[model samples]
Target chain A: MANADRIAGSDVFRPNLTGRHATGRFWQTAFLGATTVGILGLILLMLNIVNNAFGLVAYADGEDYLKYSPIPVEQLATSDLVVLLTNELSTGAINKLNAEQPLDTRSRSDLLALVFERILDREVVASSTLAEAVFNRQAFEADALAKNPDARFVFKSWVTTDFLTVPMSSQALFAGVRTAILGSLMLIGLTIAIALPIGTGAAIYLQEYADKSLINRIIETNIYNLAGVPSIVYGMLGLAVFVRVLEPLTSGAMFGATDTNGRTILSAALTMALLVLPVIIVNAQEALKAVPDSLRQAAYGVGATRWQTIWHHVLPQAIPGVLTGSILAVSRAIGETAPLIVIGASTFITADPSGPFSGFTALPIQIYNWTVQPQAEFRNLAGAAILVLLVLLLTLNASAIILRNRLSARRAN
Target chain B: MTQALSSLPVTDPQDRHVDWAARLRRKPRPVETVVQGLLFLCGAISILTTLGILLVLGNESLAFFTDPEVNVFEFFTGTHWQPQTGDFGVWPLVNATLMTSAIAMVVAMPLGIFAAIYLSEYAAPRAKAILKPTLEILAGIPTVVFGFFALTFITPLLRSIFGEDTVQIYNNASAGLVMGLMIVPLIASMSEDALSAVPRTLREGAYGLGATKLETTVQVVLPAALSGLVAAFIIGVSRAVGETMIVAIAAGATSQLTFNPFEAAETITGHIARISGGDLSYGSLDYTSLFALALTLFVITLGLNLVSRWLVNRFREQYD
Candidate 1:
């Protein structure tokens, strides 16, 4: 111990003077800071969404003003307030008695059940007029009378159930996005039908058949460029080509000859297909490229034709990737609003699209319309629509993830 | 020439009889040539599509320019974009698009590059596996949802902090910020691949010379991967430029293009959306202007893509 200390203390002994330690600490801190900020931002975004959604629910329930009750106007006007109170009590009791009357056995029970549900759902004890002023008829009546012991009954799941069953209308309570949902599904189906073949075929040609010539290079470049082209550009192209030039084909017999507008589900679908074609091609090409050259050579050596090799070996290996890409493309297509709007997708279609050639609206367009409206109820509906859209996108993405995991497992084996 | 001929020995035969038969086989067969020709033709389709778009756009734009309805100087320099009126200037729309895209790039580039650096250089295999997929989820979220998010959540938050008057209902900040968030995953994924492609030996050499992890990354790995990083940036910017729904829903439709982030402004895409909504006659200047704008957008994006491709090919290291 003494000899080591003497050596350390000696003049020839020089301490490690490299800046590596300081620089390492600096960078580690920087990296940690960045990661923290990125992850924190994502968490904040999710929390913000949840918070806003919860706020909407709270506003609908009117729980904040539940404790305050307004004095009746008759009480304020009359010196004999007791008489006014009695009159108010009599009116309420009589209305309750009338509501409970069972002219039809089935009707009486259903009314009783509905009244019970409303009483359970009420948050505030305000005068009927005040409640009417604050909450919508359904929310106010459901909540107000439910809390009043003197009142008839409670409200049930009418709002929740009606949310799904109804179709869009000017009235908030009657409005639903069923038509929009149906239109979205049809558009997605048609988009996939149009894009998958063209995209996969182009990818196959690029990866397998075409030699690495200048022309192939240009095609590859063009596809990448097309992928980045503003989706609105495709919308313009569709309007010009599909709507103006091929209006007859787009507008079918159902729309009538006078209805020459080509802003149908088919036109929107074709435009979206073009918008997402580049993404599909890029993904399909990557998948095709991942298939080992040795596999193709082996298949050919075994007397398999090029078509047979692609059909049997290449496609099976590439299926998961192709499906993943297709899902992503469809998800983007479903979320697209600008192109569809440019291609004249309707904002207020009350009826669901029965065929490809019918005029239609999609969820995004529906949400946009709802958001623009002045009413608070429509905003809530828009939130609900957004929730539905998120759920669909999440499902698609989750399936893609599952597919990718399966592919990874297979590759590992 | 002899060596090259010798490499293909099956073309020659030992005996004269076999040689004659081999010569017959050596001639290019019609079937093989025909198939190759067919493959080339299929490959030409993409080029044809590109040229077709250019030709269509050119013809339409030429018609638009000749029309008296289109004021050429006003279209280029005017700030107002009231198409409902006859006034047509593109400066405001162009300015908004460029400004928003610029803001998006500013936000996305540094964050994306840092994330890429950490993933490629610092992260363990498990961490990389988990973080990569999680980050990609950001990309998968539909842009419409993001738009709603920007409007409903982000806009209100900005209003609360900056005061109600400080932020417009449709300002560039929220759209550009959310767009930046959306593109980060894409840039990170590609940039990480580029950084990972840099040889480990370079890093080891730097470390052996007593350089720190930061020094090695900034000085050695970054310079080496400069081309790929640039490509990633260009692609990310292109994505930001092409984004439509985000700007449409969150950014306002007023084409009074100003650099102020708080102002409601329109983009070329927003103009397309707005004009297409109205009933315009076919072959009108208003209708053809859409094609002209699309053509310009196409040319810019195509130029960016070509540059990226060139950079990748010329500077990217190929490991055999």
Candidate 2:
């Protein structure tokens, strides 16, 4: 008994005591390092984006404008800016602009954008990445002035209210994510509309109706596999089926379509719906399965049919779960650009998506297009767009999480 | 099955004759049959979607192979890929795809496993709740954002560290690094589920044998959860392979069959995106080749997913 007691307490009984302890400590530190990396990466990513979104930019007005304007470009009001464009731009240029949309009919802001883009040809002469603009503003300003003596510097937050409202422009200063945001919203709405019912129905059938048969099992396996398929593959399907084969329907040609030859919001939305359907089905099935067998039996004991029991009891309980899952899936769909690119989502579109059949460009696609541009200012624009995208994603996810928690708490009570 | 059927009201022959209304009421409802049929139709649509994907891919891929310009033998054996120039070689794109995925796996696999271990074995409940959601938020960030981050932030940082000569402006390494960060949440969460699924009894036994927390976690728990860890790894690989935006935007769209991580190289997805984004005429060889590349990607991801599912099922049966 003494020996046993000694063995329990002794280092000898703890085989490889020093060795295991040392290794364990090493691993613990390693694990800590690994975990910290994720947090650090997130911090770095946010900082990087925020830094680019707000900074000092030096803008050089068109050399021709400098010749005509008595005052510096920065001091000019919106009205003066438009007047300057009319006087400075050649008659042919004005005619071309008028042909697209008459200057007089254009909104004040839109005319201003045109002035900056076509007449003034505003260019970012020199810019700093996020950090330099923040920490060494004097140095950045001096550098910008030296590079372009005529240019004016201003402190700007790229993600302003105006940035959210304006349409795309060749000029970095005038370009905005308005059209992209509208397209994304429309696409997401359509995706949810199409995917929700079918995914939920499939899940209900799998969990509540189907028995453990070979066919059911195969269906289950197929869904699991579908979820794993590369999203780009789905893009191919959309291109073929929705964009080409069913072009008349997708493009609304069958319903008096005018401009589009497929590659419409409807096609993109259907593709996204297909992309997210497996996720919804799998998640909905899990939520359905979580509903107790006892609950179903109790309903049956009261002479409720399977459909009635599911519709009245199981579905209500599972709604929150299904909703939360669908939100995350939609978030995934919103972020998806590759498949959209494959199916011919426009890289640059100024007009907001008017309807499901309208040609579109989403936030992710806009961000992608901007990132590829050689100009440094577009990167800043991409950063601002990224912030918008992140906000939209977080809001959706948070709402879903809150709803799920509340529902579950109520159920427990 | 009988137990499920037993709940419906039953009618005796004598009773039915005396009360015809009761007998008619006892019959199965038409609404039930209609609803079941509708639900079954819904389930069948998923199968149909898969078939559509396969048929679309297979049909176009066949067209691509049959095109005289697209040499099937050369597609696999050749090293260069220039669809416009009619080079038609696919291995260069394949190599780049592998290289990027390899770098991503290297970064994500160990970091993710260690993070999962820490979360499962060491993190406090509050910490777990906070950290898990935080990780999920990371996952929720759009891939486009990551692509931009890779381009503006990661690439510049890498250039500063390694000097301008080694790190090109649009290098695969930077893209791969950001892609890894994008995938870390996926790997960690899946791995956490696997690690947490390890039975407490096994852990306790290890402790009883005078093992330290680290020893039990590393040796006993990890081994017990090996299949799950493997599944997580496979899933990670699939995600890395399927990723598009990061490579398309940040990584170079130029195709080269080089092993260097810092060099500009195009991936299969990137190649397809670049070509497809342009105005390619319908029925062009370039158009069909896009489908061929997509088919390859689909098959690879599909195979990985199946293996992952099989492994998960195998381990689950053992434990249950």
- Native contacts retained per candidate? 0.46, 0.80
lDDT of 2 by residue, A83-155 (tens): 7778878999888778867777777667666666776678888766667777898898888889889878878
Candidate 1 lDDT tens digits, A1-413: 99877865776643432345666777766765655556665666565443333222222232221222244221232332323223434566545534544213323323322222232232323322222333565675556456553443222212243455446766553467778888988999999998887788788888888778887878887887777777777787778777767788887644564554688898888778777888888899899988888988998776565767888899888878888789879878888887888888888777768888889988888887776664545555676677677777787678778978888688669
Model 1 CAPRI rating = acceptable
DockQ of candidate 2 is 0.63
Report every candidate's CA lDDT. 0.72, 0.87
Candidate 2 off by > 4 Å: A5-16, A63-115, A402-413, B1-28
Q: TM-score of each candidate?
A: 0.78, 0.92
lDDT of 1 at B233: 96
Tally clashes: model 1. 10
Error of 2 at B24 (Å): 7.0
| Every model's DockQ | 0.35, 0.63
